[model samples]
Target: MWRNTELVRGLTLSLALLLAACAGAPQRSADPQQAESPRPAATQAAPPELPKSSSESPGAEPALAETPMHADGLEPSADTAANGSSPPMDFWAGLRSELQFTRCADEDTQSRHWTKRYAGYPQRFQQTIEQIAPLMQYVAAELRAADLPVDFVFLPIVESTYFPHRSRGERPAGIWQLMPQTARGYGAPMKPQYDGRLDYAQATHAAITLLTHLRVQFNDDWKLVNMAFNAGEYRVKNALKGSKGSRLPEPRGLSPITIEHYAKLRSLGCLIDQPERFNLQLPIIDDTRALASVELPEAWPIEFLAHLLVIDPQELKKLNPGLFGTHTPGFPGYRLMVPARAKDDLIAGLAPLPTAVSARWQRVALADPEQQRTLVLQSGLEWDLFTSINRQGGERVWLPTGTGVPKPVALSEPAGETYRVRQGDTLWHIAKRYRLRVQQLVDWNGLGKRALIKPGQWLRLRAPE
Candidate 1:
């Protein structure tokens, strides 16, 4: 992954210089809804002064702490205190009182606001806790070995609510909410056949590298690291300089303006503030010890592996949310994580398939204007079995398990209009823009299982049916 340390250093230095130039500069607020409102112009005015405290903001309210105790099957109440604190007059307590006393209090309303206060708590706190409790041993172990602040691990709860493949905003993606540029900058390859950012191993490695770098740059300050993570290091540096002589002694005391900027910009800072309210001790996570490695075959389905381990595919997906789909398409092989004890079972299940001896051939048609019909020859036929039928002609074709000569699948059809991919293009978005389903575009283009597309590459979008 470290292609060239010197090149990386040069890029990093350039970014740092760019950040310095932006430091203390008035930041362009990302709130598009407020675009029509009168506001300070970017070049002529300075940023407004930081607010004194959370209370000074127009709708500011104090946070609360409550017991983390769970009730078997009953509706959640504030009475239980996991932290052993007496019911105090905190925001949580008040909310709990409202919940208990109000006649209209319901599970839906409570669930929606539960995460609003606590960053890492599950959205369906009761259900999620029950589900995650069994995996705590595994999660805690990883947390301990990583020596990372426990709260940071829970950040995913805020990012994807433990749901893998969740998409938000304009192309922000995966559990970590990484954008394409940032994800690529961190070593995720944007290629025609693979997106390393969605691969858990690759993503975890990238995340760790980024976190470590941020920690070093910010002098091991977790809050600043978190802020830099959300708003970009440049924005954080600018916020720091804007605070200047007024900078807080530490992150806990950072002014509301800085905290609000981070929260509003990235939608995470307020969530991170939860542990502080409850006085819960953040655990140190050790990633190495918690993750047990299992080798996977080329193009192995991760969902199948999760099933083999008898673990929730969603949970597995959560742990490794960077993968684009159920399978890892190509590259230096893949690794699947399992419980430490299930290593033997996984290994046995993945024993390589016997090699094929006889030659094989298949014919398929292209739906595009080319209406191309192709004849292909191969010793094994796994590609035709796994990939969709509509794909027939392309620069790249999926091959079977064992390597062999790939004879072109001959096509008989007329050529169609070609379209070039542009920046910010996605199969779904592109199909919609051109009035097609994700599958239609894939079939028309003869894309492989990997479905890798790149900017500037020409694709054949068929004429309307």
Candidate 2:
């Protein structure tokens, strides 16, 4: 919920206004052939909203269109294919084996610019690779799963330097640097408790879907799809229509920044393919070290789960960056990203939590005989007295004196001893497990209707002493 603060709202409003102003503002352009000026390195803040003339707004790029997957999915070239039928042992090796667009001509100025950036500082370059090894593995796996060209794996370096939590002050956020509008358009949940864009799994899936849609829209031209991603889809479409032949014209109606983005992806792909040419060694990303997604049976507080898994909560938080608070949201069937090494521990840790069973509660009011008959008919209660009692806010009833009273009955008397609350326990969960109503748990434990339970606390399963 912290991600949805007033500050984020205010910043979002300001961004909307800024885009509106930039749309009508005149922009300067030069020949695309000349050397385009580079922004600060990928490590710095960037990809600001540039002015649009014929071009579409940067962060306001349209949501992913519902383009069907091509008849034949994009495939890796022979050179990029892994040896034999066995899976590649290394994550980076698997990606490299599937690369289809790592080549750039020797004389291409755009690609050359990034070649220098990669070669400028050998140490920093290697450090960057090491830092993003796990993230890269995840992206690579997702692309492979979707049968997308592995070349797209480098797009994040151009967008967010593979930092999941990176934000441009309410501009595109997440590893994919997805605009809020685009993220929402794709239906990647963006609740107060969770920003799906910041979640690696959610962000990667949404971006890949967009990329796939673009590939189909542009007739499988990866280059044009990359441009569409940076510039708006309509801008690229217009450029294609305006050009003389099938191929986009030089510049392709792209501004300097969009061109740079295209170059960055091509350059990064090329450099990874031939790092030896620049006297650089690419780091091996261990498949064992990558984060793995585990679908949680129920919501769990991060701190308590971390303790059970013998991991630091912050480290766990890094893997699932979207959650805004101590606990994951109560969305059913939520998936959590945890350390690959700790998957077994996580399963074991969750084994102790009570499995939920189906239960339903009916509301009824206490009233005098004649009123009760009318109430029974209206509310579907039998003639029998309710087994347990609790108050639901302001429902009409009648007292012996014929004075109007308001109360509700909770079914089933509480009957168990206190159970020590576990990490993922909720009142709804505990009540369902014991076949007791949630309201009864609240009344028995003296907990407020909205009280949140914590691990290690004692909760009364039956009526409290």
Candidate 2 residue pairs in backbone clash: 80-97
Any runs in candidate 1 off by more than 4 Å, and if so which?
1-123, 132-140, 165-170, 187-202, 242-327, 332-334, 337-341, 348-465
In the range 290-373, model 2's lDDT, one tens digit per residue, is 666666645555655665566777566666767766566545445677767788877865564333310112233645557656
Residue 84 accuracy (lDDT) in model 2: 21
Assess each prediction's global lDDT (C-alpha) against the native. 0.38, 0.52
Measured by TM-score, the strongest candidate is 2
What is the alpha-carbon lDDT of model 2 when measured against the actual structure? 0.52
Q: What tens digits encode model 1's per-residue C-alpha lDDT throughout 273-389?
A: 343443433322222224464545355545455645556665564445344344544344444555565677666644543223111112233355332323223323344342442
State the lDDT at 348 in candidate 2: 64
